[model samples]
Target: MLLTLVLLAAVLAISYLLFVSYYPSFGGDVPEALQTKYASSENYKNGAFINQKDVPEDLGFWETLKIARKFFFTKVPNGVPAENIAVQHLDSIQIADYEGESRLVWFGHSAFLLQTKGKNILIDPMFGEVPAPHPMLGGKRFSKELPIEVEKLPKIDAVIISHDHYDHLDYESILKLKDKVGHFYMPLAVGVHLKAWGVEEGRITELDWWQQATLGDLEFICTPAQHFSGRKLNNRQSTLWSSWVIRSASESIFFSGDSGYGPHFKEIGEKYGPFEFAMMECGQYNESWPDIHMFPEETVQAGVDVRAKAVMPIHWGAFKLALHSWTDPIERAKKKAEALNIPLVAPKIGQAIEINSLLKPNSLWWENL
Candidate 1:
């Protein structure tokens, strides 16, 4: 019996090592040179990056297991739409031929295409069917289609990544998008994954918090967020996570990339307030982990904190990452925004939004689903 158990343990160990070694989606290691550069940042600890304020690691082993079991085995009412969410189709010609004011097209969740100053930029473009590194580990996306397929996208001016999470920084999406994208702007240490995925070093730019980069007439600023990052189990907090501000001479926009409610919004607002529009994270939150993702009410408050002229609730429509009903985020957010007198723009999954215009998409589109 002892020898039999020993053989079983050896087999399992070999399987684990082989999986991590051969799986390209697990991503690459951060080199010592990059580690030396990251060590200078205030947010970087002994080796990994950390949140502005630490998230309490208070969930005990059994409690965590219970939550995981509930998440995987329990079914929450309306956790997914009864029907597949509809998406407005776009062709490559439409994307390539735009000569208008700055605008955005929502691809649901945290993915967007921003066209401004004759340049097209993609933000957190996770175009895969599942957000997990392996399909068996997660469910399929709520929507079957995107505004346009990644292969059909036009020449991209730049790509902005918020962090190294599987939902935000997809390996397959990057491989498909790298050739079309001229440059990439990301938080510190995120470039290592891109480099590992065969993206050229010259095309990638890594910035610490408060750092800024420019493309043509647009200014991209990397700002702080109350979140953590990692693509695999062992690499948590190994790369910086952040929010972003994209400013042009005429208008500015903010994207709260998977952040918890914190003072950073007000700080960002003070530093770059009066934004034309902002997309706030409004989904996949629970009381079990309050410091990582924002509740819907907190989402609206973050919008107000940023002093945005109008706000759009994102991070809810594409996937079911939380226990609440999928529509709960938008419903709660709308109520709070109404109470606060904030203009809430709730566009459909693939709707195109004109950022410069006062006319916003505020229809209750999710109700139809």
Candidate 2:
């Protein structure tokens, strides 16, 4: 019996290794030459990327067991919407021919199509049904239909990626977008995944935190975020994670790409403020791991720290990634923003808001769901 059990364990271990190795969704690794190039980055450590502040990457064994027990046993009411979320559809012709002032349309989660200075740019465009590599491994998107299908998108000027996480940098979405997108911009080492996935090296540009690049009249700045990154078990922190600052002659916006509340917000505000608008991450948080994702109150504070004229709560109203109620993030964010006397724009998915125009407060659309 002992020998049989050992053999079973060996087979299972080998199978797991082969599964991750053969999976195309697990993504590619940075080559040795790229690693040597990244070694000079202050954020790149002995081998992998490190945050400005030391953030814990893994939970302790006992804590892991405790969380797993709760995750499997403890049920939270309204953790997901009762029915498929409603989407306000977009017109492909309008998007393809837009020559207006800067505008943005949110595609539910952290994805956005920003039309600035006559250029269409996608930020963290994860348009997959499930954020996971496989549909069987994750829940379906809250909405049955996207605002616009990936095939219907116009020619993209660029795509800004914040990290290499499966939720933010989706493999299937990238495959659909590569042909339409002219360029890809991401943090250091992220280009390896794009290259592996068939994007030309000449079309990809990678930058470290605090680095800036220009595309026409717009400036793209890779800024700091208090987060760790990995798509597979062994690749944790192999690629850097960051927020982004996009500025044109008349409009400036900030995207908090999955970050915890940190001093970096203040630093970014000092360097790039006062932003006309900001998209703040405010979802999938737990008290157990407070250092990587922000609570709703922290989300509001981060916006204030960044000196945004107005703020929009993102990273929620789509997938259910945590134990909180589906509406908890937007609800808490509204309350905090009210207390702080800041304008909070919670537009319905696919609604376009002009950047130069006044951002009026949105109606309570999620309350009825």
Candidate 3:
């Protein structure tokens, strides 16, 4: 019993040290612009953004000990094995073959390989073993492996990041891919972390809300999302959070990075309506943090708000970040989409989805997983 207690103490000490080393706390005071904005904004009153009043008081040492004991003793269900999840591989998607049209391949979670107007773009590529700061520490990755390894990918024209969250912006994945990417676009202040991760400054492009930049024929419009951003506890909202509208002459796609149900979705739809396809957030939600993650039904509504002709749910099935059952997000999302008469598609992990013909019969591969 004494030996077990010593081992537990050592493990906890190591975990704390690692967290302190890798996880940066909130830096300094909030920016003046952000401070002014927060002061005037109604989000503060309604607990939309930062709820200083709602912040939990620091727990006493014994209180912390009790909580940790409860958590460690609790029997959380293990996630489904990666091999159990169904995946599909194509010889070649041939996105360059499709001119004046769009194609997308869902790489599970928020990662997508988008081919539009002869250019290949990757969005939030978290193709790593784990989504935590260190591979050995975090939960398991959802799929067995990417259909195509990062090295095997064709020359990528651009990489777009929604925020600085570990799941959205992986460190090892970026290190493996920094050389292959031509340009990296992300929300303002996110470039700091990317730069820390060794991406060249010239290749990184940071944009404020509603900002637009072009790469070849594709235009990436960074838009607002009702979400918070922070890598560590102290850095909450230090960087902006956003969704992106990737548009071309012939096709437009909306990638909802991660957001809850809010007026922003409708505003985004009004501005960039009638998208050919929308890859929206649809998982890892709980009532405890309703302002950050959207519920499954909210995802369907977000699809409608974006005026998406066809919608594919993401952010679920790949990672069990919330307490809900593994299949709960998709199951509830499907019901909501059907009730609203919204066109929806559920592709298997690593499945190639043709935007022009999204309704084709595909196996319900996630059922047995």
Best model per TM-score: 2
- For each candidate, the alpha-carbon lDDT, in order, equals 0.90, 0.91, 0.76
TM-score of every model? 0.96, 0.97, 0.82
| Pairs that collide, model 3 | 26-234, 26-235
lDDT of 2 by residue, 145-223 (tens): 9999999999999999999987899999999999999999999989888888899999999999999999999999999
Most accurate candidate by lDDT: 2
Candidate 1: 10-residue stretch with minimal lDDT: 356-365
- TM-score, model 2 to reference: 0.97
lDDT by residue (1-369, candidate 1, tens digit) is 999999999999888778867899878878888788899999899898887787736476699889999899988999999999988888789889999988898999999999999999999999988998888878889998887889999999999999988889898999999999999999999998999999999999999999999998999999989988877656778899999999988889999998999999999999998899999999999988899899999999999999998998899899888899999999999899889999888887677889866444456778967
Q: After superposition, how far is residue 204 of candidate 3 from its true place, in Å?
A: 0.9
Q: Could you tell me the lDDT of residue 62 within candidate 3?
A: 84
True-vs-predicted CA distance for residue 304, candidate 2, Å: 0.6
lDDT of candidate 1 at residue 288, scale 0 to 100: 88
| Local accuracy of candidate 3 as per-residue lDDT tens digits, 103-154 | 7788788998887777788999988767776666567766767777777777
